[model samples]
Target: MDTKRISYLYDRYQSNSLTALELEELGMLANSQEFDSHFEVVFNKIWEELKHEEVHKMGIEAEQAQVDFILSHPRPKTRRLKFIHKIVAAAAVLIVVFAAGLFYRSFQSAQTMQPAYAIVPGKQGATLTLASGKQIKLSDASKGKLANEAGIEIIKSADGSLIYQIKDAGTGTSGMFNTLTTAKGETYQVRLPDGTVVQLNADSKLSYATSLNAAGERRVELIGEGYFDVAKDKAHPFIVKTATQQIQVLGTHFNINAYADENVTRTTLLEGSVKVFSAGTQKMLVPGEQASTRENQLSISKADLESAVAWKNGEFVFTGQPIDEIMRLLSRWYNVEVEFKGPPTKEEFEGTAFKEKDITEVLELLELTGAVHFKIEGRKIIVTK
Candidate 1:
């Protein structure tokens, strides 16, 4: 492909102005050896634009959506570019997925035989509990308007995520509250009335008011893990309350891991500032900093932000985490039981993998690392050194 055409396509992809057919054409071009031969040019263009930050998270995510759509649908034709598009789509996915911390499968070495039974990956969905204590399964909810609660309109978008809009700001003060919960092997995203977006991972729950309270504090209680992109409202601090601490932010993006089974609760700030209050102490965190709390005691330190927000961004990022920790996460997403063959080993691994891929792929990757091996029998995964 000519640089002029490729450059234009890349610009359109970045700006998200590309038509459906144009995106397919771009995906096809990106999957081509000809395009691969000149990847340096486009790669450099992207790096030049987004060198200081993560390169095109929105754009890459859009590309991922396209690739996923293409894969799930039947092929159109067997043209040269079409065949190349299918083959290169995986390669193209690696580029963007790796940027977001998903382990690229192409880099793995030869794999040993996987388990007899393979486990499919998790999908995007959750359950919503209204103030009346009625439960609405998001998967069962159709597209468009789902409900009107406390003057807040709840809609399930075409992409399967939930959106909330305020029908009347005057009615926003209602005491009615709603909750979103994700069961094991499921994940979801929902926008709150204040425009804050929350992505819930497997086995997580977020409870928030139908609208802002009279106290001027937009607070939400979280159990398990979730990522937040808070809309700016300095007058009303967006407070994320967990079992261990309260993270107060004024329009920021962050990730919090508050799972009960974990030893400590972690809050990682990605952008903007957050004040963490716990254990009778308060500390402010900047971008790339994390607050870890156990009991009432809290500590501040630099953290792996990528790993922190990996689940929200659709990947499993292990930053030198122990095998036991890894299995705990896998257990939630795969909805399976994990058993150790013997004593726990002191091995750590640093890598990433797509959360929506087969569980066998991850186990086999670990197996290849000489760290551990795995066997599957029904819904149980046995790990051995």
Candidate 2:
């Protein structure tokens, strides 16, 4: 009835490495209503971990085969087990079946011909362009003060974050400006001089004045996706400008996706309030609301805050998003090219992947959906139905 032992046995069973004694112990525990609560908690935890590790999805045919195998296997007869215990036992069997299916697919993959290619994931890196047009590759810069301009010190923190600290408040308001850009396969975080913090996604850019309030307003121009936690400054409202819209806030936490390739610009508010303006139209957004601008028109709706800011939290969350759009995101983060062999499928994907995983693992997870397959050649990924 020990939770840890139950978890260990479950894992071993999934991997097909459980010994006869352990299997018997797990089966006995599964038939007992005394540990029904423990079993439920462990079941949920294991399911989440499997999904997080990108091994939850499997082909329908393979899953059905595993289910058949499970049904044919002998089970100990139990008359006193409660209904809840029966459900728990059934759920545990399903988890083991899926895990077996995943293992079978992995073995099949390994038996196939191997390729000579690999693509890694993105990491923390950016290019900082000072007001004087001097570019600093932040990835190569040491952890210390990189530059001093107009009484503001630009330092790379020990954790690889870009920080702007004021050396002299009197001289902080210079007319100079700076820009931070992240190339493909890179992301970066910055603490601006005005105490605001921003996390830039891959293939993005942010331009702002060194003092942040030089133009009588704290404004920044964004070229791609970015998460902003604006510092509270009643005297100077924070403004974020994109190609299609501008967001104004006194202080708020929000995420903006305005990639040039994307058709619409989406701004999701997480805390406080923000006013989004585009083409003479504007909408005020409360927390958990999203404002989307397309073709000079603006609209508001409920927001999926977790999916909106997943990248900033080192995750890739997809909620019924098309494969093409998903490929676009992977292309940026993996610094690779994607080609469709023929007509693209209309299938959509719904799952969560860690941004830190390699491109191959993610592709394998997607392949489990059976809606698409992939072939990697050098840095290119070819998609096919």
Candidate 3:
């Protein structure tokens, strides 16, 4: 496009004179393959010179300004103009260069704007709530009797999870109940009265009744992450409920991850079969299949059983996910603050690391991707250019 034509488009866009379709066309022109390199150069100018005061207040406008400016000016006309025009054009070039520098600095500033809250994993030595509404501390003696309710006794096994089983012969009906909770850095396992087992992950809770002898279905509540091996009792089914999902099973092994901070709640089946219901929808999951619920929609897809359940077995895995997302997961599990000190780029990572690895070692391995640099000061990780 000629200088005059480009200038006209620039003015129109700067003043919001273009229609929606025209704006889209302008974006297409600005983001064209040939203009990709110089796109930022043009964007900085329009954003600084023409962006409205109110528009500038919105956090997103800086990015929009960059896009709009690129469409407004294609190339400089320094070679064709007279001395005075050339001088004016030279001054504009200097201004554009100066603005680019400021944009880069501002981009650096944007990286440090961290989320106020983080979803963290559970720690060892977490507490549990008994059927009597009694809270028991788990740090000292590993094994203890929790409670007896409805002819069933809830006990903490030598291992971390709570177990509910029938205690004595009884003619009347009775049930036991207990809940297991983990702090920000722990994992625990529980075996139900019906020979079913559950592994509780960090920052997680599981509530279950003691008696499988009841005529009704077996039910449990989950908060964070857990792997369940439901014992088969066709007459009595097992049901696991979370904030947004429910899993019903006759006899199956599966993992439910419904951490509040996570955008999606996932149910991964390992063996047998399960019916996952949520958001007014239901789907049966076969072994090696997974169900994901996001924004009140449920989707089912085949999955890798070993990879999905790896956390229960003690490992961390990433599957071509963005750096920021990976950092968020790390922050939760390790209980640390993650801050970035430079420009943010769309970079993804794929790898596995042991959950036992310290925060520094994990950051070092991530730095190997040449995508980010990290400086760890105690529990805080500062990401840099």
Point to the candidate with the largest lDDT: 2
Candidate 1 pairs with clashing backbones: 103-352, 103-353, 279-296
Report lDDT (CA) for all predictions: 0.76, 0.80, 0.66
Best by TM-score: 2
Model 3 TM-score is 0.63
Better of 1 and 2 by TM-score: 2
Q: Any runs in candidate 2 off by more than 4 Å, and if so which?
A: 1-117, 172-174
Model 2 error, position 332 (Å): 1.0
Q: Compared with the true structure, what per-residue lDDT tens digits does model 2 show for residues 1-385?
A: 6888877876786576877787667666766665556756676676555444333354434544654665566423211111112333344454543433332343233223124755789999999999989999999999999999888899999999999998876776657889999999999999999899999999999999887887567999999999999999988999999999999999989999999999989999999999999879888999999999888888899999889999988888887788889999999999999999998778767767788877876786676555677877778888888
- Listed per model in order, the count of residue pairs whose N, CA or C atoms clash below 3 Å is 3, 0, 16
Sort the candidates on TM-score, descending order: 2, 1, 3
